[model samples]
Target: MFDSRHIQTFAEVVRTGSYAATARDLGYTQPAISQQMKALERAAGTPLFVRAGRGLRLTDAGQVLARHATGILSTIATAHGQLKAITRLESGRVRVCAFPAANATLLPATVARVAASHPGIRVELLEEEPPDSLRALREGRCDLALAFSAGHGGDAAEADGDSDEGLVEMPLLDDPLMVLLPADHALAGSSRAELGELEQERWIAGCRHCRGHFVAACAEAGFAPDIAFATDDNLAVQELVAAGAGIALVPGMTLPLLRHTGLVARPLAPAVGRRVSAFVLEGHETAPVTALLLRTLSEAAADMERAASGFPRSEA
Candidate 1:
């Protein structure tokens, strides 16, 4: 009989590309990881890995076994979560990671809804850039990650490259992109702002990803912007816009937070939006707390959109 623990160790080694790294992640020594792999190979009477240049590559048999191991481990995890939820011990910890703007706006409501629904479940929030949030989900540091990317005109183009294995993404909401300007600015009274009209004004760029997104949107309208301020902090970007430092492309969900003495948000004329998405490492979907949290987040986002449009939302 194959030891599930040995199978897990072997899978980790393959996923991490080195026994040393796998050992560090699993809290075992390098020698221990090697011994576990060797023992598994001995039991199966076959070599699982071949030495590559400074690393290891899975043999055909190893590749097959690793895949099976991953699935088996995931199934076990799901079963355990189900059993835990069944006995009314519906308590478990989940970490959520997201970008600053998302953290500032969507997360508070999502957390509130989850807390009301699952009083026993504990959720800890981690602030990270989108790339790091996705990484956290892949590496098991976070159970779920809230990630966002520009809407590809309603097509399902994922925000980042699909490098993380066994991951799934669900679109939560379409947050309309808006132009935030000084309250007394000439364009503040306008119902909508065209991308081309802002070409001569100083602009605040959020992060590299955000900058790229804005630049691409402007290119669609025939100009590249002159960035006067660049920051990873969404609040700072809004503060700069409020202080008349420069204008910014702010998301609609963020408008409520930025409603201030010196700022006004106007929808874009061409109507570009970004989709906020929920990510879960696949096979962990049946975890009750995680599932409930995901459902609450999706419903909260829809409620926010409805509220913004002055539509009646059912009681929360």
Candidate 2:
């Protein structure tokens, strides 16, 4: 059996690339670091590191062990945190990744609710796109991921074949993409806009994924948009529209989040929307803090949907 201390020492060596550096970081003598490495090698019956000039390099076996060691260390840290929280639901940390709009709208309210209910739990939020957020969840870097899928499928969790990773996805909302027009634009008087009608107008493209959807949606309408600017910031897109730069297709959820004036948003004739969802590792759902946060997020999503329905419709 390999000691976790030795495994951690090995991982540190791989990261720092030198026994002397590892010793300095871990407060151990260089000889002690060497002793641990040798013991680790003896246990595995292979040389984990090879002398390369003045420094050291991991052998193939060492590289594999280092990879596993990093994961093992992360798991141990997470287990320690959970155990600490289990002792008393008083304190725990939940790492979450979300896209920008969700961060602005959904996460703040949800996090506030979680904080009010469980003052001891700390929620760390990271802004990431859907793919990156899902990757973080799969790699154990985050406990939960707020992600979205458009026309591709229902839930991102169900779309993955890595059941062994034990991911559970819950659908949150169907946030439609809407057309944003300058307040005095010719189409601003309409309740909705067709893609074909805007063929002559300059356009502002969204993020890469959203731009792809815009392109595909426009192609389906038998015309291509004249994209004038490409950006991921919804607020920037709105600002540009207000300045009459170009029209844009923005997610409906962003409407309430935007505080900017002088622009009107109308639903698309054949509404296109993204389905937002929360993804968590299967076993995490049972944790008290995680469960509470999940419930809070659900409540927030419901509230947003209700509020969105009452939002003033664009008119002349």
Candidate number with greatest TM-score: 2
For residues 241-260, what per-residue lDDT tens digits would candidate 2 score against the true structure?
Answer: 88989999888888876567
Shift in Å, residue 219, candidate 1? 1.4
Q: With candidate 1 superimposed using the best TM-score fit, by how many Å does residue 183's alpha carbon deviate from the native?
A: 1.5
- Cα deviation at 291, candidate 1, in Å, is 0.7
| lDDT string, candidate 1, 147-241, tens digits | 77774322222345646467778788888888888878898878888888888989998776667788888888888889999987667876798
TM-score versus the correct structure, for each prediction: 0.68, 0.69
Deviation in angstroms for 138 in model 2? 1.1
Off by over 4 Å in 2: 1-88, 152-165
| Colliding pairs, model 1 | none
lDDT of all predictions: 0.79, 0.85
Residue ranges of candidate 1 with Cα displaced over 4 Å: 1-89, 151-161, 311-316
